[model samples]
Target: MNIDVGILANARNECRKLLTEQVGVLGVVISSVDGFDVASAVTRDLEPAKIAAMASSIAAIGIVVSQEASLGASKSITVNTEDGFVYITNIELAGQLCALNVIANSSAILAQIIYHSGEIKRRLEVS
Candidate 1:
């Protein structure tokens, strides 16, 4: 992704909102499809770089899985673990494709998390 500074700033700012305003959001990562961390806000000693790469891989697999199942183009992938949940979706920043990864605490409402994930994608998009 050809990440522009303006787009990066917007992403960073949105990530901050996820951390400060949104409850149950443990981390937010916006990474290039090639596995580069473009912008992120993480807590509790979470590593953004590692998650960024994994998100890219996960998204790639999602795309393949969707194609194999004839499910059309995949937009996102969600993972729920025993302790928490991870949401990974594709976001376009200034026409560049990137992954928007959100981690939520176990106590988080699943519906709320999904709703805010859409909001984050809408906010981070550059026209």
Candidate 2:
């Protein structure tokens, strides 16, 4: 199925909005399940393509692990480091698979970020 450019633009705006509204957010990306970059809002230092590819792999791993454990489908995967957090979540809207990825500083609140991220994922789903 073909994705609408207008929808993609709106989704990218939503990503930018997430970055602006959230605290400590360094970047945000929306990528397809097959590692294609859909839309992204990132800083100069971050490479959107690379982030999308890595996030796709991470999301795939989450899905696999969930299936192996019989835990049903994975909703999100988060990686916390000493200085940053990487959030990768599956965007499932009418079975059109996509991934939402965000990078935030260590100071960011995980609960808030995850909560808002879920909302962003849902918004993207409609597009």
- Among these predictions, the greatest TM-score belongs to 1
Per-residue alpha-carbon lDDT of candidate 1 for residues 50-112, written as tens digits (9 for 90 to 100): 999999999999999999999999998989999889999889888888999999888777687
lDDT of the candidates, in the order given: 0.87, 0.84
lDDT of 2 by residue, 11-101 (tens): 7898899888888898999888888888899877888899988998999888899999999989889899999899888875345788889
lDDT of 1: 0.87
- Measured over all alpha carbons after superposition, the RMSD of each candidate to the real structure, in angstroms, is 1.3, 1.7
For the record, the alpha-carbon RMSD of candidate 1 to the native fold, in angstroms, is 1.3
Error of 2 at 43 (Å): 0.9
TM-score of each: 0.93, 0.91
Residue pairs with backbone overlap in model 1: none
- Residue 69's C-alpha lDDT in candidate 2? 100
lDDT of 1 at 18: 77
Query: Model 1, residue 63: what's the lDDT?
Result: 95
Span of 10 residues, lowest total lDDT, candidate 2: 89-98
